[model samples]
Target: MHPPRANRAYRNVARVLRPVLYAITRRDWRGTEHLPVGSGFIAAGNHMTNVDPITFAHYLYDNGVAPKILAKSSLFSVPVLGWVLRTSGQIPVHRNTSQAGDSLRAAEQALAAGECVAVFPEGTLTRDPDLWPMVAKTGVARLALTTRVPVVPIAQWGPQLLLGRYAKVFKPIPPKRVTVVAGPPVDLADLYGRPLDAATLREATARVMAAITALLADVRGETPPERPYDMRRGGGGAGADGPAAPTADGAA
Candidate 1:
């Protein structure tokens, strides 16, 4: 069953914190009603700024759902933040091979328990100068297929403008207008009986990314540049230095 008590508490905290976060960031959310009311689903979004997750969590909390994000394991190393995150039951993801299985297992257990989880399919922040979303990783698709959970695509804008890429050092710019938009959940029941092969997984993932891109376009009211977001000539050259690359249609 869903963690109703925990979710309720999360919502209460969100109601109190969102206003404060908005006061600092000046965020404006739209289309949040598109999110479903309960658990057993995955809410996925584009990863741009580091603050994107917090923005999403706060919004979800305001809308009556406490979202548990799949954060990088390294974040758990922080002193106080780590303690709060662990006690709150946030999922820790190990991107490296050594702990990937353990992370996946943890996610599976969470899903089986009827909890809602958020994932940034892009894996990491976009390094492209324009900040268009890059190709997404397949982990989200694999998780959805494994757990048979519906996937909800969310589009967020404005956080990058306030925090920019240097939010770590610089104070966040104030009174920035941030927008959060949620799309209808993408159903994968059609593939229930089919083999979960690479092609199928990619197809599903692409659809999810497309939904997010469309929502982003709506919020920005402009078409994104068509060039690849990752412009590095070779792989690994796109180390966290530049803006994120543009994604091919459904390339994520």
Candidate 2:
């Protein structure tokens, strides 16, 4: 397996940001052995704060896998940030439109090329009050099964200290300790080759979420709730059923 390639833009960005990130946070990253080598894979992680993505990216980059994250399309329109994202090969997700499927297709192509594709399976930051993972959209599951790629469950904590959920302030003053753990590729062998029905997707997705939640539990040194929070039924979500699951053929 060839080591993942990093473009010049990604390397330059990392060179600039890595030192600043190290200065701002005490890192406790584990499970490097779980990341797949010489192959493409999906990284499904829980979202707590806006800052977690940075920390998460730092972890993967340091481990030698340059992550291709799925970010909202709106971010690609920003001035300098957009240019960086585009040039760095990050994929844009066009939400709630006929073009929504395009993102998954792009992801599939990336995976086929042996690149790492990262996604926040929860879709948005957790609203569990205590920052536990909520019931996630099934897009991650869809991607894993359709592409038959490894789905590595990653859990991140401590970024909220830098910037709390939905908060606009970045308080990196005294610095903070950010912990991240990556679990082995989720075992979906039993479900593979089965029909991609609602039940199958939910069960597969639940496994993915559970793996992530367990890693979070390890980082937090506490037990998680009996079940993940449901953002739709609880509040602050879309239609009655929540976000629609992405199709295997590539609709997200």
Candidate 3:
């Protein structure tokens, strides 16, 4: 089905930037069909580079979904860029602040309104040196459990090669090839609505991470380590993320 055009601000910006992004990168998008249309849904993915949002958003738009991203509240405080983000439907995440609870509420309202909300569960680029998905903020699972929206576990690779994390280098040479894959919504059936306690949330969160990791492994043609890397401690092994990760970043 043809996607109705997004808001004017989003349309205008996409018209300008999508072409520029296409000119500099090759896209390998898969499983767009897995993202069900005509309803609100959560698209959760592993974060790679700073530019991953742009690439992932482009992929979503191309497949007929306008993306409303959950971004750092600080990014919305920037000058012109912040103005654009706010106007174009990005959600702001107020980390570690009292107002933090506001983000998830807003996201739930958006989902209830049938908007597709794209989330980077990692909260930041993978702290993993080799770029495997690391411990994640539990916000995604919270949103999934509460909203009962399909949590489509997605994975992205190769944008990091375009521009290394937290660096200013851009490699447009062969034009970095970016791949995004969407897996089926995770099965949180048994855990859903059990009790929003720590144990329940952790189990659901682990399922989200595992689903995302499997998709990434499929794209990379390699096995992910038995344990997800932990950012705070700088290591990964069996049960590293264990029972929890930093809890807030809600709505992921």
Candidate 4:
């Protein structure tokens, strides 16, 4: 499923961009050992900002694993970016219900071919004001169960600070340290013998998000906001909620 010339060109571009990105942010990553050394695995992460994918890709490339992302279909309609994405074999997913199956099929094929596919189980960027991850979708679980592939949970922070989630601006703030943490592989062996039901998928999604949240807590060193967006009644900000709720991974 390699894209020939497109992939080669992308590699060249990535090589050039990697150094510049590193220099600009002085980015630091941890937990590279947790990433599967080879292919046939799904990299699931919480979606916070648009730049999160690029950060993930750069981290994987630095660790010697090339990642193919399942991106929104609208991104493929861009000018040069679309060409690069198509040639580089990135999957485009249509959010519409009718075309959702196509996206899943593409993911299945990519995994079947022993390639690494990165997916954002959160579906959309987190609208949470305090930056805690939102409730995630079940797509990643569906893919993992159907393909029986290892799910590597990735947690990233600092990218949102670079390009504020709502600001659409890249601030030149100095040394805004970004961290990419990859957790150990999540095994769903117990569910292998059963069908992929809603309950199982939801459980897997929770586990994936919990892993990411733990890594994020490690990176930020602050408790995540209890509720997604810390929403409160009467459209007010996050009230003095109790301590952050425990994630499925048991991290507070």
By TM-score, who's the top model here? Answer: 2
Winner by lDDT between candidate 3 and candidate 2: 2
Model 3 steric clash pairs: none
**Taking the tens digit of each residue's C-alpha lDDT, what string does model 3 give over 1-252?**
325638888888788777787988899999888998889998888886766777888888889988788887776765655665787778887766777677778888989989888887777778788888887767777788888989888898988888788777678787888899999889998877598776677677778889999999999999998788987677884222222212212222
Q: Where in model 4 is the C-alpha error above 4 Å?
A: 1-6, 78-84, 172-175, 225-252
Better by TM-score, candidate 2 or 1: 2
The lDDT of each candidate is 0.66, 0.80, 0.77, 0.68
lDDT of 2 at 16: 74
Which sections of candidate 2 miss by over 4 Å? 1-3, 77-84, 235-252
lDDT of 4 by residue, 1-252 (tens): 222322586687575666667776766888888876545788887777766777777777777777778887766675645664676667776554576567677778877877778887766677566677766666777788888989988888887877777565677557567788898988678877776676777677677777887878888898875544422342223221211111111111
Off by over 4 Å in 1: 1-19, 78-84, 227-252
Return the candidate ranking by lDDT, descending: 2, 3, 4, 1
* Model 4: how far residue 76 lies from native, Å: 2.5
Ranking by TM-score: 2, 3, 4, 1
- The local lDDT score (0 to 100) that residue 225 gets in candidate 2 is 83
The residue-by-residue lDDT of candidate 2 on 37-156, one tens digit each, is 889999888888766667888899989899888877776775655665777778877778887778888889989999998888778777798899888887887788888999999999
Give the Å shift of residue 123 in candidate 3: 1.4
Report the Cα lDDT for residue 175, model 4. 51
